[model samples]
Target: MEKQTPPEQDTIFDEAELLGDGYDKHVRRARNTIFVVASVQFVFGLVLGFSGPEESKWISIGIMSIVAGIFAGLGFWASKKPYQAILIALILFCGLILLDVIFDPASIFKGIILKIFIIVYLIMGVNNARQTLRIKQALGKE
Candidate 1:
């Protein structure tokens, strides 16, 4: 096995080198997609907050919106600080899942809207996992 480079000695590559070869453009495109997806979730949350139950649903919607906004911000931050971006994304994801469990204990498919959110969240997890792996590989940590 190759020796791990000392964190202090190793230079952090810019986002371009993080993607390697021709993948930087693809990474940017992925970030754009993440932004779009998060924006959609944010809009959905607003709609739910305005239209659903005042006590429970609105609270859930507000949390969802906050999570979505965080996700979008992470995408933007990834351009400048990819490692921290990925870390924040992972934490946000865990928080989102926990929120979902707290808000919808009766399974995400109880409502079509909730189901859609669940699917979107699952996709977000998968996408984030791929991005994390890419970042790790680029850093020679994988």
Candidate 2:
């Protein structure tokens, strides 16, 4: 009798748990995105910090830097912990915008810088929101 060929080897992709770690890929992706984005922003902030603020814009830069520092800190935390990272990022984004409004400055240049932060903040917001939704969904909470 001809011996039957051994059964075809199962590939790793054929496994039931290819998803890996049961962790939400979307959340992981979003966290990684923020980590990269925030790291870039942190570097950018340093560059901007060196440029002398406009005569009347020192206060504005100080305020914006404070806000940015907070965001960077939160982004750092999120980079380390995806679950809480999204929430903190969201809070940091909103807080930056609020600070921008609360401390309006006269210099257009400073305002534009604040606006850049707003834009970056928005990007972070979107990523964080997505991560938050993914985490919640994965947990079957909502």
Candidate 3:
């Protein structure tokens, strides 16, 4: 272990090293993906607010803004807690998608391509974070 990793550096993220090497790549990707999700959600909320029924306009916008805020917060948290943040983002995104499908079966066909891409990217990010953490733990790093 000593030969595999430098001895001087210690980090607060459960001893996860943040400096050097390419270990931060997955975390960065996860964080960026989260921010992108938030941005898209917010924009969708805006678009829906104007296009949807008048009665639900404000409500829909409010709910989406809140969801977007949650993602944004997780993105910021990823800098300090990559594993937890990424995991939560993955679960939340999946859960929301599931809920949408459950509530509206036809919604699945609405944006099939975009939905697939987002799910794939989030899954990849989650997998990357998991592997990175495992490797760091093995090396006595992250």
Candidate 4:
């Protein structure tokens, strides 16, 4: 009688299948993109804050700059904790959108198209960050 070879067991979480080197590259690109975007936001806020015509406007711009700086910092911190950073970014984005709607309801209709584009962009960024976190976890690097 010929000896029979045993079949290999199939594992649910195969490291090779679950984690690809491409994910690492993707995560790096996403992190850099987010950081650049946040930095630009902070810089623009700073310019607006400083170049305002009136003291009241300056104060508002200053507050906006501070918030933008915070988001930029969060983007940098995403390298270490992507999920937390993405959550904070999303929360900040939502808050800003709410404030915009509350303060300028009339302008909202005029800029509805622009606002929609921004909303979509923010959603994609959040998704990218979330995917980075998942990839890290799956790769056992988290």
Best by TM-score: 3
After superposition on all C-alphas, the RMSD of every candidate to the true structure, in Å, is 9.0, 8.7, 6.2, 6.4
TM-score of each: 0.51, 0.42, 0.76, 0.61
Q: For each candidate, what is the lDDT?
A: 0.63, 0.54, 0.81, 0.65
Worst 10 residues of 1 by lDDT: 114-123
Candidate 2 lDDT, tens digit per residue, 91-124? 5655655665677644335556655654564455
lDDT order of candidates, best first?
3, 4, 1, 2
Error of 3 at 117 (Å): 1.8
Stretches of model 3 off by over 4 angstroms after superposition: 1-23, 139-142
For candidate 1, the lDDT comes to: 0.63
Clashing pairs in model 4, backbone N/Cα/C closer than 3 A: none
lDDT of 1 by residue, 111-135 (tens): 5574454345444544554675677
Rank by TM-score (best first): 3, 4, 1, 2
Q: Candidate 2 at residue 134, lDDT?
A: 63
Question: Where does candidate 2 stray beyond 4 Å?
Answer: 1-23, 54-81, 105-142
lDDT of 4 by residue, 5-107 (tens): 9675445556556645655454455455556556656776777667776666777677767776787787688778766775676677667768777988774
